[model samples]
Target: MHPQQQLALALLAYAAQRGLAVDRLARQSGLDTAALLSPTHGPLSAKQWHDLWLNAAQLARDPTFGLHFGEAATPAALGVVGQLVQSSRTVGEALTHGAALLPLLTDQVWLDLAHSPQSVWLRFRQLPTELAASATVVDHLVDFVLAFVLHELDGLLLERLQPRTVRFPPGARQLPEHLRVLRAATLAAGPPGEYSVELAGACWSMPLLTADYELQAALLQKITQWQAARPAVEPLRDKIAGYLLANAYLGIPSLEELAANFSTSARSLQRKLQAEGTNYQEVADAVRKSLALHYLKMGAYPIKEISYLMGYNELSAFSRAFKRWTGHSPAHYQPASASRSLPG
Candidate 1:
């Protein structure tokens, strides 16, 4: 459930431009400003993205905020996906590339392309998650995505797309005025919680104004090389260990909680772990050991405080584990220049 940080970064920039308190928004969303700015930082969890949109909605206090925010999105703000789309030869090709690369932006949502004899349909769907069930959040997100797509289409063609029909979630039927961006199209409510836009079948063949064959080839090559460098699917054991390590300071999650986070039942998760030659306890212990050793070597905090940070209920419990791991007391790892005081 980790989504690329680029979209979130763009949203933060938008919030700042709109005169909202970006710092406060980041804090409310449980996002660290430093991490958000760091190129090495991993993608944000789906919950953080949800919280960010929720907080933005609250702060803006404007029903049309998402629409405007999305309408203003620039290709520069969208990262590689934007650049690749811009370099595509035609409307259809650009959108196809966008759909294919959508996962690189956020795995939570996907863009689908369907065709009939007369029209091409672009569907936007969000995978169901506990955080994704928020109607307010979904409503705005749908608005943002729809507007952004339309904006991109119009930009690529150097002309207004004039979709034959635009469909929105049932909730938007009464707020047609808020969607003036799609005024040329016939507006209709789709399913209770679905969104899509219908464009002329011929629109797919429309040439993009900014198409560059050389640029597209180079971008595609770069993307292919990047994908080749990473595993298609991370091993479950490694995923669990990474999760435990990241959250060890906040207290480790129980097996049930971890299972829920990974969208699996406890039994299923156990089976998967067993198949990977590890179990929940083994992964947790490994993460704890790694963190414990790293913290001890850093000599930044006393052994007692380190125990608490590592989620140990008592210093004796931590000491025993440390002895088992290193065949020595935790104090032996401390450097002479290290401070004895706890971190504030």
Candidate 2:
């Protein structure tokens, strides 16, 4: 199943275990229980998914409520990597291996890494998917990847963990309950949209999760060897992303402009993109979606400024596009209470 469905199931299971009514939670999150249960249709919208996760967290009083969704089952693609992780020498090595193995599971996502002398920022990248429900899939993947690795590392279940910041905003009257679960001091005011966890490199040794050493090492090595021969699609996607990064939010380029930049005719470009399982519009949308999050995280630019930069002639146009991208309005996307850091 896609990560989003897996995530929704995970949240449903957690709520059931906690003795909370799933229907009630669904209602609170503005979800239709029947629709959520429909497997034939695509995933829920980004906002709908976030609202459900947020509602579940509030009801369970656990920030990690969303994280636990992956533990219930191992995805087919993640099996080998899961073994490698289930078996690594240390938490750091395991995570490093897992990060490298991420592409094997899905090239649609990328992990963002910010390494410093004192701290290491391990951020999950949510690549733009053409599917409307792709945002939820991205969200669930972030939770799943982190929770799965942490669980194997600690060799124990972590009921108390929470993201330092939730990707979506916290619901009203929910912070106290969430605080009870996370038990971590939150930053006062920070970036508007990006969700992050700031941890010291030393914290890697803190034993968030535990596992067997030899088996994990063998698994890691196997994954390493397997990845060596495997085709890496991210490089190609990044090439496309690199092209868009230069003109982020300016406006969508014409088919000719895009094809020229890539050094090919429009027909050839279309064919190549189709072969790559994406197209011009998909790539352009992905670029803008990514830029939206990156700029939003900076918190310096106003919503209108970001909208314009994103190539929206008016804020409303940007808002509509953003909603389609993130399932939340630009104004409503940024968390109000969290402390934001300035871009360096």
Candidate 3:
């Protein structure tokens, strides 16, 4: 999904504030600064967003850049969605409204609220098409989302609203100091691929200081009109791409498997994709290429591990594929300044 341009602009602003070169970052990420600042700019693709974060982290030389960026982010950075959430009557109502209107910001992930007798869990789950398969990209994205949510909650309550438990995805590399923003919450890695914060039930119904019934009603109407005009269905290629990214750990699905998921025969699926001027292999290759480039650009992972991540059983196979995608070998893409060793 294409994320609103405002998010990218906010990140650029944060980078500039930290003494990073925003022009170089924009150039590396294939973004035009003038176009981005223009009122008529369009949303960025999931790949572009991933590239921007990767570039930002590299320039800052900070693995926890996303966490810091989000810690400093304000609701105004989120554009319309922020305004609507701020005007909510209660914390629960704000969260509900935010989750419902999340697509206006980005459909890459959705916000979900789960309830138990004693606590409320706020979870952010990536949509199948969110192409952030690299560990680096996933780490930054998850950190930003979690920190941003906590920051917004604190703003609403006018106090440090500590979560009962803060969970990170397994294999996350955040240091304790980096997570100091989480306050005194119990920190533990949750499921293999999930991120969430558990809040006490008492905080759920707390009134938001910024609540304005009239403002919320007005914003909701405008958002509703905007949503009504959006296309109801995603393109076939995009759907297939999302499926691949979401289930990459299971290995790339076959044409038949993809067809079954969409409730169609393999032949029918092929014809539909062909009508869109591409085939299953083409779409699959594109997803693999995007994933490979993202990991390679980070310069953190070895080529072997990256190949495995791309679902290649043999290093040689992945090497050949990389060569075909780009004129040069993978080594040419890895930055010389990057450490060959992984971070602790």
Candidate 4:
């Protein structure tokens, strides 16, 4: 997929506000400032997007560049999905539309929604390993996404938009000023290995300031047509992972079955996964590891029960796999030690 030109313009605008010129940013990113500003430009590739972010962050000299840039974005800046979100009837509907269109944004991560008895959480799940290679970069990305959501929702429905809480991934270390600068009311870490934003259930049904049933219906039609016309560029790794999660209870499907589901041959599936720097077994193991950690931390399931749920015939097999994945026995991996509750 190509980089959305709207984003390039937004990046330029944000940098300009900070006294960084388009040419300088372009030079650092090896991007054509002219092309990025063109209305007809296609979406940027993953690497191109990464370079643009790094350059902007470096030039801004802000550890939270993504958050800052997100604050500057408007509804139209998000393109089609943004428009749909703007016309939605409620904040919850806008969130639904946002989650559905995430596959179009970046392959690096997809939205994962989790609901607790207290609140509903929207998390970015299954991030690309590369995104996690640097903790600082990941931190910026979390704030960046959350800031964008808040900025777009600003004064559109409520007098002020705020989440019940802002949650970072388990291992992330938040800066002391994160809450003050980000204006987060409640900030904490959760068990997910990636970032999440919590929405108060009470705010979910609030009517959108821009709601128009007739216009929104027409927009929905347009979204359907445009999405079908647009090519899907979601990463295979993510697709496979999603498929596994969807069908996990039935059993971890075989490579052949997965290939069949994707309408391809096993060999081709293997080749594609290989190109993405992963394999079927590796992906399966990763899914099991994530789910296992989730269950163990819940403290409601027995070790043997967790093993069976994860597709292991015996508890020993699951334990071995767990140790291999995290270098600790199931009991030794006190995931709950890090937090009061893990995002389910």
TM-score of each: 0.58, 0.36, 0.58, 0.56
Q: What is the descending TM-score order?
A: 3, 1, 4, 2
- Pick out the ten consecutive residues of candidate 2 with the lowest summed lDDT: 169-178
Q: Model 1: per-residue lDDT, tens digit, 1-344?
A: 12368788878877754547899999999999878878877778878877888898788775656665666565655678887877788888888988898777655666799876698998887676655546677667767767777766754553566777778766654464344655435777887656788888998888876532332333334334434554546678876765554333334567875664444578999998999888998888777777667767766667776686566768888888878877888878777678773321
lDDT of 2 at 98: 72
Error of 1 at 283 (Å): 60
- Worst window of 10 by summed lDDT in candidate 3: 211-220
lDDT of 4: 0.65
Compose the digit string of candidate 4's lDDT tens values, residues 1-344: 13256656666755754546668888777788777766667887666666778777777676667765665455555678677888788877888888888666665667877654567778875566444424555565556667777756653553446676777777777764456435668888877776777777766777886522332333334334433543345578866765555334334656865664444578999999999999999999987886666656655556775576577787777777888899988886545554432222
Alpha-carbon shift of residue 240 in model 3 (angstroms)? 46
- What residue runs in model 1 are displaced by over 4 Å at the alpha carbon? 1-3, 172-174, 211-344
| Model 4: lDDT of residue 128 | 64
Report lDDT (Cα) of residue 335, candidate 3: 81
- Clash numbers, per candidate: 0, 18, 1, 4
Best by TM-score: 3
The local distance difference test score of each candidate is 0.69, 0.52, 0.71, 0.65
In the range 1-344, model 3's lDDT, one tens digit per residue, is 12368878988977865557899999999999998988778888777777898999888887777776666566656777777777788888888887787777655666789776699898766666637446687677767777777766764564567888877777777576344656636888888667788888887788976432332333334334434554546678876775565434334667875664444679999999999999999999997887677667766667876676576878888888989998778888888876762221
Q: Once model 1 is optimally superposed onto the true structure by TM-score, how far is the C-alpha of residue 68 displaced, in angstroms?
A: 1.1
